[model samples]
Target: MVLKYCLLLFTTLQFIQARKVVDLTHTYDKDVPKYPLGWLGLENFTYFKMDTLAAQFIDEMWIAFKKIEYYEHQGTHIDAPIHFGSGRQTLEEIPPERLIGPGVVIDIRNKVTNNSDYAVTVQDILDHEDEYERIPPNAIVSLNSGWAQKYPNANLIFGTENTSDPTTFHFPGWSVEACEMLLQERQVSVLGVDTPSTDPAQPPIYPCHIYLQTNNVPLLEYIANLDSIPPRGTTIVLGAPKVRGGTGGPTRIFALIDDDQEQEITSNSASRNFMSAIFAFMYLNVFRFC
Candidate 1:
């Protein structure tokens, strides 16, 4: 009976674990900067509206979500193919299959601090091939340039400090070369970062965005707390966020890690399917028991 209880508990825990979610968004505030070339402005944000005891009864007032309407480009956003081209997926077409993948992190803070225009290169991806090998295709390749820590100083963080150079944008970006390395070579479906844009903060060289999205790739910008995810062996989840015909909706994201004593997570779909079924059964049983 004790052995059976242990199995039941173990199965229950493993099953419910598949759905752990993480928030990969950065809050929009006054400090976020607009590129000199970009024309965007926030029109409505939250201003204290009237409170009333109406909806539920029992002295029920609400501090509601009266949002300031602005372009999706203002905050942490996923760019649709239509953002750059006409007649493209309006954020709704992003395939779930492509949206989630093995999360890859390349910490380029040191190099980026020295040279703000640093482009993520082929060699950089090569160095982390071992990590990438573990993640499935269509995974999110996140570039960590330590840029988010500079959020307080939006100007300096964007690399607009005393450089007097146009490429003074402080962090690294996916080079068109690196984009190919990620997409064509690695076959990644999405590219992500913690900075304002996926491309380096420069003009006449938006190649990274063009290259990635031209192939229907997506971008996740303004991510934080990636330090929590393991370097490998974790399944990242983008829970189904319901936004109607929305080109892109803000996502809640996180990592699902599996520690197997015998086998490692790989490209074997059959194995993954089996594991997923086991977890699903466990979760259903737990819910039933509860």
Candidate 2:
């Protein structure tokens, strides 16, 4: 019976270890939509053939380079604290550990569908907590407003009838009350959104950004594929360029899924010790007999 159980546990461990990685980033191209604000979007990528077989600096050296210009906050990007808040930490000040963590996706797609100008409120957070329990500390809380499907559509994605007018823009995002709950009360480290900003478009002032930046919480904007990730139980890895004193920059975000539900690979030291004992028992008794 011990040997049988040991084999079964080993197989289960192997299965759990084979984690699946989901890319939660959008590919930025010329066609990709820019935020309706007056800033110029990504410049056309200019490529130059530096060397070839006939025009090579060395015998077998071939090289090419491209000049690309885009706003730091353009595409799938991270907004460091210094983006808005004065005397706050920049991109480099955010430690690597803070960039990755267990994540929860707060989906407000239905609300967005009903009202494009809807804002995620404190009640939404409380409701999610009532259902899913308290969100883990230092977790990356992602707001999925279901706007990613309209990517590359400058008009639709920004929810603006006039691309030039910021006042006409409309979309779903975090309300000030919601930010207070998540940042001040829950102490979440990062806030990610599928939209252009954490606040609803056309806010009198970007209160969500102000609150988060003042509190030194980074924001990940223009994230894609939140529809694929679960509401909770996945680990998020943020890949962004670490520019010293950078106010913000583009980032690549991803997640690792191990199980279908709350069931996850063990990390508790006591559980690890218990598993070790089982492994030792199997090696000493079952393996020798075999």
What local distance difference test score does each model get? 0.63, 0.79
After TM-score superposition, the amount by which residue 177's alpha carbon in candidate 1 deviates from its true location, in angstroms, is 1.0
**What's the C-alpha lDDT at position 212 in model 1?**
71
Model 2 stretches with alpha carbons more than 4 Å out? 1-18, 36-62, 262-290
In candidate 2, the residue pairs with backbone N, CA or C atoms under 3 Å apart (3 or more residues apart, or in different chains) clash, namely none
Compose the digit string of candidate 2's lDDT tens values, residues 1-290: 86677678777765544455789988866566655444436343431122223433565677555555565767788999999789998998988888999888998988987798888888898888888889999899999988888886879887877866667888788898988888778889899889888888856359999988988989998889888777887899999788998998778898987554423433434544565686688678776654
Q: Could you give candidate 1's per-residue lDDT for residues 67-97 as a string of tens digits?
A: 3434455445677765665566666566678
Off by over 4 Å in 1: 1-10, 16-22, 28-68, 130-135, 161-168, 239-249, 259-290
> Considering every candidate listed, which one attains the maximal TM-score?
2
Write down the lDDT that model 2 would get: 0.79
